[model samples]
Structure formats: C-alpha cells, structure tokens
Target: MDTKTFGQTRLLKACAACSVVAALLGCAAPAAQYYPDEEQAIEDEVGAALPPGSAIVEFTTNSAAVAAFQQRVGDKLCEPDAQHIAARVRRREIPSEVQQNFRGLANFLSLGALAQIEKLPKTKIAHYPANQPIAFAATAYITDGTCGPLFLQFTPQAAKRYSLSMDFNGQSCRLGIREMDESTQTRPVKHSRWRCAEGFLGIGKPTLIGPDEIN
Candidate 1:
C-alpha cells in the first residue's frame, strides 16, 4: 500500500480504539448503579405483596442484641421510645409499658433500618396489635453465607394481623411474620430442606412474601 494510505489507516484505527475505550469508561458508573436497582427489582418481584413498612431485620452475632439478650430479649431489641416501658417491665412495674413498646417496635425498628436501605421511602405508619407469638430456632447466615443457629421469637402487631412467612436458605433461615393468631407455635418449622434465594428467607423466598399471600 502507498505510504499515505497506510498512514490514514493507522489514524482511523487509533480513533476507533479511543472511541471504544471512552464508551466503556462512560458506562462503568451506570453499570455499577444498575446492580442495586436490579437487586431491588428482584426483591420486589419476590417481595411484591409485602405490605408497605414491612422489613427484614438481621440479628447477627455482631449485632448489639447479642449482649442485650443476656439481660432480656425484649429489652435488647427494644426501641428507644420503648425504653421507659421496658424498664418498667424489668422493674416489675406496670406491664402497660410492655404493650406500648411492643407496638412501637413494629414501627420504630423497621423504620430505622428502612431509612438506611436505599429506595425504600420512610413512613409513619402505626404498629399492628400484638398477635400470637411464634418462637423458633433458626440458622442465620452472614452476608458471605456462613451461618449459625439463632433462637428467635416473632410477635405480630395487632392492626396487621399475624401470619408466618419463611424463606429458606439452605440450613439457614430468614424469618418474618404478619399478624399473629392463636395458632402460633413454639416449635419451628424445619428449614433445612428448603432452598430459597440468598437474602430472602421463609415462605417468601427472595421477596419474603409468602406464596399464598402473593397474587
């Protein structure tokens, strides 16, 4: 080929390479942001029917609750607004504070966590009434999927009514409950056999909404 033609060809190839690199660099930020939205979409698809204000509370060994549990589970998870009421209970004073704090927790704890979660808007919804209590032993996994047993008790708020929803993650479990009823039990449903998506547990799988409750 002529020298002039060869020079022109090299210039065009260099321009094309630069354009491709620029395009890829431009897409990097958007691609990173898209993953979170993608995860949310997956969660919404799985958790679609979850009533507004519902949340996934993680109580790990690293959580403050571990220390508090030695004193009292109720106190450990108690909301700040509920502290006075919880103190009354520990002091063997009026138990009225117990119910108030219990109700407050459904809103307080959920809202606090939801605030830090991207995309979920905050709301001032009232707590459901205390329904029946469901107690169970669970294997709670870390973000890396390593897990250990955790004994948990879920008490549904009154206004919402109580129903249990479990999404399984191998031997681990993520537990959530709707309104509680007289049927709540102390024995946990066996979760070792169930396989659910990571981050979602109980009957809801990825979204955490029970299959029966979903459309």
Candidate 2:
C-alpha cells in the first residue's frame, strides 16, 4: 500500500483502540498533570512483582514529543485507571487563525502553564518484567480535537536496557521501542526498533506474526 494509505489505516486502527481505551480508562476528563511519575512510583511499591533479574526500560519522553503538541492524550501505561493530559488551552478565547500565527505565545499563555507545566520532564524510567507480556499505549492529540492512540504489547529481555519513544508526524504516529545493546565498547552498541504485535485491550487486529520482539 502507499504511504498515505498506510498512514490512514494505522491512524484508524489507533483511533479505534483509543476509543476503547478511553472508555475503560476514564479518559473523559484529562488530568491536570502530564506524566504519571508518582503513579509509577506507587506501582513499584504496590503494583506487580517483576521476576528476578528483570531489566530496565525507559521512555525517551513521558509527555508528548512537543509540549501540548498532542493536545489531549491518555497516560502511557496502557493500563486501566491511568491519567490523561488535557493540554488545556482556552482556544475559544483565541481565534484559530491567531493560534496558528502565534504558536509560542499561545503555548506560553495556556492555563496548563499556570499550573507549572514548565516543570514537566521529557523522560521516564521503569523496571520491566522480562519474558512477559507488557502492554503500552500512546495517543497523539492533534489540533482540532483529533487524536491518534496506539496500544501495543511486548516483552522485555532480562538484563537488557530498552528505550522507547513515540512521535507524531501528520499522517501517522509511531511508537518505537528498541533494546539498547549492551555489548562491550570494543564493538559499537546498536539499538534497532522492535515491533509489538499484540493488542493489549482489544486494540489491533493482529496483522503481525512473531515473538522475536520479546527479546
């Protein structure tokens, strides 16, 4: 299929998944905060128990690639009861034409900023269970109330560090997860994006085949 077609298809799938997730996760109201840093910390104290020797996985970003770039989105864990960020801006107060014309000004003067959103971070680290199904979700809230959400499930390898990032560029938003090769410096370390085929919560139709991603 062509690039546009592929993008549209992916976006459709993501939106479908996003709706199901929104219903299950109570996404009707967006959280004032961005990342679930405190939530994750609480999880460590009382969530799930990881197998011995579980490795680490870090998100290159806890929030959207651009602050408020994804206008409104749910939490990243892909689990129920996760928080959502509602990049609150009185867009009604400012004309759309003006917003398009003065992007930085609009961002700086948002009600969310008054809550000290400037203190938000772009990265998050977590302890992941190895060789087990782990679910994750990301939604890119585009302008004009359009949002794309993708839910994926994969497993991490023991003793390996994984890095994951999500980006949205118009047609499609991609969630790229890669294992950071821990090879000695004698050989250059490499990190290649892996694929997650499983649908965490009735999301994708499973067009993928392979457990290779678990490693």
Score each candidate by Cα lDDT.
0.26, 0.40
Q: Give the per-residue lDDT of model 2 (tens digit) for 72-171.
A: 1232332334444322211111123332454444344453332243333444445756776555545544332333344445556787666555555444
Stretches of candidate 2 off by over 4 Å are 1-52, 61-109, 114-117, 183-215
What TM-score would you give candidate 2 relative to the actual structure? 0.43
Give me the displacement of residue 63 in model 1, in angstroms: 15
Candidate 1 residues lying further than 4 Å off, grouped into runs, are 1-34, 41-130, 140-145, 160-215
lDDT tens readout by residue for model 1, 134-187 = 233333222223232223345444333332222333333333333333474323
* Best candidate, lDDT: 2
Give the candidate number with the greatest TM-score: 2
Measured with C-alpha atoms, the lDDT of residue 41 in candidate 1 is 16
TM-scores, all models, native as reference: 0.20, 0.43
Worst 10 residues of 1 by lDDT: 1-10
